[model samples]
Target: MTNHWLFWGFWVMANALASFMWGSIVLSATPAAFAGMLLGIVVFILVYGTLDAYLIKQNLSRWHDALRRSVYIKAGLQLMNVFLAFGWPASPELWAGIISVGITQDRLGIAQNHYPFGFALLNTLLTGAILSLMVAALTAIIFFIRKKHESR
Candidate 1:
């Protein structure tokens, strides 16, 4: 907390590592889904980092509170992503948002031979949901440990 840069540095590094790992798993399935990988990392850092900061500033009064809120947000986003991927034609604007980040539908479409849209959608959603839960649990454990240490 005393060193702000250190906190941000660690945060960015951790986020990047998670993004790449997820990217790798995604690529393994689709192979030609490079655009998705890039979009996932960039959007995650920009969107999630900004939202997390704002939530901490406005709603979260403590570190643990922010982490808890983040868990909910991440889980919700994964569900939303699933819906966006599956119901892309219904809510077409979702593609715009994703494309704005540089991942075109054509790129995703190219992998249809190996990974159909539905298959990719389900795989991404399932993996993201599981990872989000794991991260949330880890955050909760860290929060409790820090609280306990401070209390003692």
Candidate 2:
């Protein structure tokens, strides 16, 4: 439980930073706003999802030598999912689909458009940040529980 909390905290902070960065880019564009937003999402997927996947796999492999095979397989599947979702075009429908899937997995809520320029930007940032935090929290809880059971 302690470990889960720690992991969740870290994830929330990371996601907050990521959201702010992406939201700023998305909201600052004059024309081609959608395109810019897409670009930002792509960058985020590449940097956060892919790179984090690698790091996660490495850590898991090191932590549980006997469970490496299964852990690696699961991580691979997650990476694939992230890649697929990231490659898809960014639209309200697409986001809705992603949010639905995430909700089914107990991840995060849907992203909605906000009012006013500043408010919209803040909301966008919060949406991403909160979702990322949820993912991290869930992942940490699962891993911690598994580790506890294994140890017992």
Query: For this target, which candidate reaches the highest lDDT against the unseen true structure?
Result: 1
Cα lDDT tens digits for candidate 2, 1-152? 45533443444334344344434454544434344344434444444445445655677543333223332332333333344456754333234334433452344332223223333333444355445444455556666777788899
For candidate 1, write residues 82-140 as lDDT tens digits: 45456554322233333422332354343434554443343334333445555667676
User: Which candidate should be chosen as best, given TM-score against the real structure?
Assistant: 1
How many angstroms is residue 34 displaced in model 1 relative to the true structure, after the best TM-score fit?
0.3
Which 10 consecutive positions of candidate 1 have the poorest summed lDDT?
Answer: 92-101
lDDT of each structure? Answer: 0.46, 0.42
Q: Can you give the TM-score per candidate against the true fold?
A: 0.43, 0.36
For every model shown, the clashing-pair count is: 0, 0
The segments of candidate 2 whose C-alpha lies over 4 angstroms from its true place after superposition are 1-31, 62-126
